[model samples]
Target: MARPLLSAHAERRTSVDYPYSETMYASVHHERRAAFGAELYGALGIGSGDHTARAVYDAESLRFYGAPHAAFLFVQGDGEARLAADVGAYMQTLLLAMTAYGVDSCPQGLLSFYADTVRAELGVTGGRLLVGISFGYADASSPVNQVKTERAPLESTTAFHDQGPSSESVRP
Candidate 1:
């Protein structure tokens, strides 16, 4: 598993750092994230006001949702936006391949918050932790697995130029 990740990372010829801006999600993105969170917790019988329940649920990421295997993705260089984009692309490909192999995977940004601890534990040096992926056979009967968040329609998220005003555009 590590070999494939390393190979892919090298092939991409890019090194990354953290994957988010200082503001993280803002405006509409923040709203969407909040809605998704509500949907997720609701599926688990947790109310929006249930702070205790939310904390416990969030802690599941630290345990990788009881996954048997995990992968930490890192890049060897200072933070660069281009390299971060490349890493993101690599992550998508890796996740797709895992799905094709019947492996269930979850990409956890929470892990990056403990980047220093992870590096210390792994005895790694000089790489910025980008993300961590937890993977294993999924429990088909789990209620959490049943949670599905709605996606914003393409017309509301994408802009088309040089086509015509009739074409879908996110602009006002």
Candidate 2:
């Protein structure tokens, strides 16, 4: 099953245009994506200017990073933001559970780009693809597996409103 899916994905290599509006991917998100790519490719000795090498490395996602099992998540709807959010939460919980059980998993939004190919291959109908997770034991010896991207600080991503309205604020 994985082989057929991989072959179909590779055959139809052209990913559809992003399913959501560009505004959703803000500058901060772009920065993080760039950082993650740099870390990953750098770990494999692929230079930033090497587009061919980058593409080859990225193609591994379709191969599920050689994981034995893959799961594609889909929500029944027309790509509503709320539905996507709910699926995202479900994915997080699923990933955490896999971790607790010592099963490695990588959630790939890249898979959603080829939703049509996936749907056709899996005989799925009437759902918006949200994400695909590849799960199995990770190859610890692989350099690609060694890359660790840093996370933004809590303060940078969160705001507190513990206190009531500020003294300078006008109340209704």
Q: What Cα-based lDDT does every candidate model obtain?
A: 0.77, 0.83
**lDDT score, residue 170, model 2?**
83
TM-score of 2: 0.83
Q: Over the stretch 1-172, how does candidate 2's per-residue lDDT look in tens digits?
A: 5556566566876444336565788899998988998888889999999999888878788888899998999887666778878888999999999999999999988777887777878899768777889999999999988988788999999997787768888877
What's the lDDT for candidate 1?
0.77
Once all C-alphas are superposed, what RMSD does model 2 give against the true structure? 4.8
Writing each residue's lDDT as its tens digit, candidate 1 over 1-172 gives 3333333333543333455564876689888888888878887999989998887777677677888888888876655777777888999999999999999999988767666666766788877888999999989889889977788999998997776566566876
On lDDT, the leading prediction is 2
Task: Give per-residue lDDT, candidate 2, residue 148.
Answer: 84
Model 2 bad stretches (over 4 Å): 1-23, 163-172
**Ten-residue stretch with the least lDDT total in model 2:** 13-22
